[model samples]
Every structure is written in structure tokens, then in C-alpha cells.
Target: MRLLFVFGFFVTYGAVLTATVNNPWPNFSGVIILWFMIYLITAPARRRREYWENRRALQEEYWRSSIRYQNRYRY
Candidate 1:
């Protein structure tokens, strides 16, 4: 999903850039660069989100296994 979004972003940016070749008033590079900078800045937060999600999944799996172990030992 993230890959798709990144790909879409570059594709859109390229398309807009190509479309603006005739006009020289509004420069899109700055806007695109700004957005790319924002994306780079927010990368850490995205990684943290992914980390937390993975940790939560692992914790859930551990609890499930613990519960099964306890149940198996209960005679």
C-alpha cells in the first residue's frame, strides 16, 4: 500500500511536470520538493507506527500461546 502510494506520488508528479512544460509561470518543482521533504520528515513516524503494530501482533500471539499452554496443563 505504501509502495503504491509512493509510486502514485512520483507518477502524478511526473505527469504534472510534463503537463506544465509549456507554461513557465507556476513552477511545480518547489511544491513537489516540499511534499517530498514532508514525506521524508514523516518517515520516522511511519516506521514507529509499523513497529508498534508489529509489537502488538507479537504480544497478542504470545498471550494466545500462553493461554493454550495453561489450558493444556489444566487437568
Candidate 2:
């Protein structure tokens, strides 16, 4: 996480420097646009990962309870 923050800092700063050197506002926003695009692209994958994680956890709990119930009723 710390490394990610440092990398992000350098990337944004580097973009700013590049834009300033070129003096183009439209292209300057390209860095922000690129990041937004990346986020949009990954959103689905991220949600899918979370969905499966939750499903697995719920299934585990369900089976645990089922086993406990069966044991309680055993002769």
C-alpha cells in the first residue's frame, strides 16, 4: 500500500510536469482521464471478486450450521 501511494504520487506529478512543459490543457487532463478509464475497466472485476468472496463465506457458514444441526439430532 505504501509503495502504491508513492507510485501514484510520482505518476501524477510526472503528468503535471509533462503537461506544463507542453502547455496543453486538453492533453493535460489525459492523465486523469486515463486513471478514470482504468478504474471503470477494473470495477467489474473488483465487484466479481467481492461477490465470489462473499458467496464462499456464506456457503461455509451454511455448511457449518448444517453439520451442527445434524450432530444435535444424531442418536
Best by TM-score: 2
For model 2, residues 13-44, the per-residue Cα lDDT tens digits are 65765575456543546667666666777799
Question: Of the candidates shown, which would achieve the greatest lDDT relative to the real structure?
Answer: 1
Q: Roughly what TM-score does model 1 have, to 2 decimal places?
A: 0.47
Q: What are the TM-scores, per candidate, against the unseen true structure?
A: 0.47, 0.52
Superposed Cα deviation of residue 70, candidate 2 (Å): 8.0
RMSD of 1: 5.6
After superposition, the stretches of candidate 2 with alpha carbons farther than 4 Å from their true spots are 1-18, 22-30, 68-75
Write one digit per residue (lDDT tens) for candidate 1, span 1-75.
986797567756664664566785545675577567767987999899999999999998898779676698677
RMSD vs true structure, all candidates:
5.6, 5.0
Clashes of each: 0, 0
Q: Distance (Å) between predicted and true CA of 56, model 1?
A: 0.5
